[model samples]
Target: MWMGEGFVSEIQHNRGREDTMDDVGHRYLRELVQRCMVLVGKMGSLGKIKTCRMHDLMRDFCVSKAQEENFLHINNILSLKLCEVQNNKVRRLAVILESDENYIEGVKFNEYPYLSYRVCCKLELGNLNYLQTLVNVRPKTIQIPTWFKFNLLQVLKVRNKKGAQDAIQMLISRCPLIEKLHLYGHLKKLPEAHQFSPNLAKLTLSGTKLEEDPMETLKKLPNLKILCFRQAFEKISKYESVGRASFNGKNMVCSKGGFPLLQYLFLGTLYYLEEWRVEEGAMPSLCRLEIEFCSRLKMIPDGLRFIATLQELKIIDMPKPFIDSLNEGGPDFDKVKHVHSLVLKSFCQRMIIVSS
Candidate 1:
């Protein structure tokens, strides 16, 4: 919230000549400035004004009256300004820099002695009651608050170098109804045979690996519509006894019932593509598929038999035979009358057109 001297001069200039200022004129102008600040701060806390406006207004007020305001005066007014925030606190609350840092510097927790209001240094999402989506990139480790139980959470993204994966599992376990989840580098091992939310629609697991196959976790998600595995590098030792590591083979992706409602699928540079068990009835509703940088793929399994409604298929940086299998299948061509576009790229580019 740093303001240059030029800004102060501009405000004074806008206030007009000192000679023209009667007692009423000075009083009204000062009151007007204070009134605007109070209204803006209140509106910000009430979630009426955009967050940016609140930050801007606070910055301007602070800069305009630096000499007149002290730490206590500023802190008291800002606290009163923020008291208007009602219940159902926003999960994605962005604490702008203009927010009262003195007030932010006052939250306290007794148990975590190492991380008091002082160690925390800033108040990001401490006092919020309904925060479900939180991703802060400060030097702090996000520990899930105990009060946070099953709520109406649908999306979560968190990144911390330490305890990254554990945090993700904790959130997933807590929010059983979460519909979409994206994790970037947080999760050492997938949950050990736990039931996932049946309402899960989209999942993105990036930048992590596991000693065990994570297919069982996917099996728990009955309503999963979109699945993405991006840059998830697994240890070579994890696949020692595994058969050919390719979803493109005679026997790949196999499950009890398969992806019953899955529609979109993306597998990116995943070293252990062999873990996918292209089970029968899996991907019954699959429509879009993209496989990129899966060098280990030998062939796409014939078990992908029931993708009857597939519309778009994309294969990149895979073996020759894998591409051949897809070309031979013609995209369950009998049922996928809606599928008119296909893209295959390797050393060259080829586009195919299909019609009903």
Candidate 2:
């Protein structure tokens, strides 16, 4: 049984007693259940139940309510793929809109004035409000209200162009519990502020220009596992407090302790990198490594000696020296024992091998 935060709150408020549908929010929730609205999850204490599907009737009800009052007034409404109700809702509602073109007009963050004052949001939360999961959607630079401050966030998928580093900084500061982060689209600069979240896990940063101590900030994510810098940095020194630190031996540096739990690594078009530090047998948990379009990478860091668990390896579009070195890993190479797949993008020719 999965219910949204709003429903969970109502249930908690009415616990150990008769459940009355007096509150307008509560009434709508009851009506949704009584009507047997085929919601994705369950209807009970807000955080107790989980939702897997969205009910069409629930969506229609919201639209009708908005049309009747000429505006929507609920504070928290969890939505998925409901684009048809875009124009109806007017004010004071937290909503999650994913992959819906029809609701684009009404789904803009600028439409709501109440977000800056309360923690209300349409984002998903399983049992704690500290962690939220953001699904896939178009990239857009959104202004987070001043009041939003969750402690833990598991998933953050923002694919809009307006995605700014400042907003990400604000989110990191507001929600200290961010563990898994995924950023898409062009995020040009890193926040000037020096803040960190130690509980992070998988990170995906794509199509952004790095002008600051992106790695310096990354050092703060002590629990990181998978790292993806997909075009996140072009000039690492632009955002740094000092410009010299950007290109002076620091740009290609790796952490001294290195990533202990790191499992996967992906880098794209690293133009400024002359060397990468693996910290002498670091990243003991690394298994999969993929490099693409990195012209200046001279050789693999010695830190790879620590990876006894590596299985899958991919090297694409690199200099011949780097490719030649990859084949020399000794007989006990962790990848050979565990890694059965090796994909070489540059020199592999198409061949059809028919199996019986």
User: What's model 1's lDDT at 11?
Assistant: 27
After superposition, the stretches of candidate 1 with alpha carbons farther than 4 Å from their true spots are 1-127, 136-140, 144-147, 160-165, 192-195, 232-252, 274-277, 328-340, 347-356
Q: Residue 312: error of model 1 in Å?
A: 1.9
TM-score of each: 0.54, 0.54
- On residues 1-356, what C-alpha lDDT tens digit does candidate 1 reach at each position? 01111212222334575431223333444464577653332331112232222357686766557535422122343343343323323211223444445325433322210121223454444344434344332224445466665454545554434355545566567666666666555356665435456677777777654444555557567777887777633344965532222122221344657667778888777655553446557677878878776767655544454556777877786665555555536543333334556665653435432332
What CA RMSD would you report for each candidate? 15.3, 10.9
- Per-residue lDDT of model 2, residues 1-356, tens digit only: 11333344543244456553224444555566667774436642213233434467778876788768755543323443335345543433445434433233334332221122122234322233433554453322344457655543545565535445555666556556666666655555654323545676777777655555466556445677878866543344667531111222225555655666777888776666767766654566777888775667776666555556767667677765655555536332332334545655543434321111
Best by lDDT: 2
- Superposed by TM-score, candidate 1 places the C-alpha of residue 331 at a distance from the truth, in angstroms, of 14
